[model samples]
Target: MRHAILITAYTDFFHLIDLTNSFNEDFDIYIHIDKNIYVSPICLKILQSFPRVKSAEQVFHVNWGGRKHVDAILWLCKQALSLSTDAEYFHLISGTDLLVKDLQQFCNFFDKRKGTNFLEYFLLPYQGWESGGLNRLQYKHPLDQLNIKELHDRNVYNRFVNWQITSRRTRPLPNYPIYGGSSWWSLTRDTVNYIYQNYNQNGWYDRLEDTFIPEEMFIQTLLLNSPLKESIVPYNLRYIQWEHKHGSIPAILDEEDIPKILHSCALFARKTDSRISKKLINYFNNNRSSNL
Candidate 1:
């Protein structure tokens, strides 16, 4: 069965090259680069040179915890679906992610579960998020207009959130249940088509315009509240570390973490760095022929 690897990336072009190289003819790669960053021309040329790779014609300046991130993902999904209508599955991942499994093993795993949607999700009022995560949707978060990397902008955003909280100002929740989870996932073509169709027909796109980190909630919420809910598998099949270390959350994977990554059932691992993950990347590259 053919697969579409849809990627949303801003940095680490070399790692992205390694990622795309891992797949074979059975997969078509679609990438959406964050328009805010200046990518080297050589990097873009090299990426486009790949036989099965396609860079998105429409790009967005994605901001963290903003609606634009969700928009970019949806755009990537749209691009992939439109171009590869026959692909059976589409896997969403970041540029820094490395495949932990060989192409054969990865395809085999999905081949056996033809219709399953693999993602990490939990219903709202989840303890993992602040105020049960309702605050994200209940307040106006103008993250798209503000650069989170700027100290002044971050301060302004924080004060705005605090003011909204103190004043008890909140918008009404959507009429349906809200679900949240990791942004990455593996979905069947049918499920993705359903999301695209429903999102456009329903008013969800406008409704989520100012929601915080809607990327994590948009797809999960849409699927869980529909007939396709039964096809969802709770695991997203990606290994990610949540522990904060070296000043990074979802701690950057390194050579030392190879054992844990290999032991996990994840098909891929994320948040890798070109500098920190050189050994880890080399390990996988050297052993690409193996079934690990």
Candidate 2:
């Protein structure tokens, strides 16, 4: 079966080289680079060297607490899916992500599975809130306070909407608890096609991106509600530890962390730097080949 990796990149491309060189899987690699960043000659050369790596065009500028992340993802998915007609699985990866398992083991694990979709689920702690169950912790942006009708109605006049909707007075509307997890996942072609065709075909796109752009809710809700929910693995293979109180991104992996990463029973990890971790890649390659 065909497999593809989709990496979203903004500025720093150092980690990307590590991922590209380490992945032994004979799968297509696609990258979505933020259009705003200027690509240096080294970055361009590295990208062009890999015949399997295809550039995803029409990228948008994304923000931390904005809908740009969701928008860029949607656009990237469209581009990747278009080129990956024969692909059985599409692995959505961040630029800072690294492959823990070699190509053969990774292939074997997924090949043994019957269903295609793989994702993780965790509870969203927004049920008790007064803002209708929209989790503020997950999204720092106070989208709930925005006047939905007014914001939607305005073209460019109401762009500067602040202080008008106070968070102190706003409250949660009492929706059921949302199951959320990591924004990254691996999706089957059938499931993705179903989502693009049926659910997202309506105005749900804008609603998801702009209104309450919770990373976990939108995809989890749609997938669980779909007829193909039974096909979901409910266990994405990436192993990450987010124990810190204010942890947003995973810690950058170094040479010392290689041993723990090897035996983690995970397929991938994130936030590995390119300059500091050549030994980790070599170790992975050696161990992976031996295992095969």
Best by lDDT: 1
Q: Tens digits of per-residue lDDT for model 1 on 99-183?
A: 8888888889988999999989999989999889988889999999988788999999999988999999999998878899999
- TM-score for model 1? 0.96
Tens-digit lDDT track of model 2 for 1-292: 7887877777557667656666544677777776657778777787768777766343665544455666666666676788877878888888877777767778888788846688886555544333544533322353333333354534232442333244343334224435556778888878767766664533444445443445555566667766887888777777666543223345666667787777787788765555555666566657776776
Question: For model 2, what is the alpha-carbon lDDT of residue 91?
Answer: 82
> Pairs clashing in candidate 1?
none
What TM-score, computed on C-alpha atoms, does each candidate reach? 0.96, 0.77
Which consecutive 10 residues in model 1 have the weakest lDDT in total? 54-63
Clashes of each: 0, 7
Off by over 4 Å in 2: 56-58, 126-133, 137-177, 199-203, 211-213, 244-248, 276-279, 289-292
lDDT (C-alpha) at residue 12 in model 2: 56
RMSD for each of the candidates: 1.4, 6.1
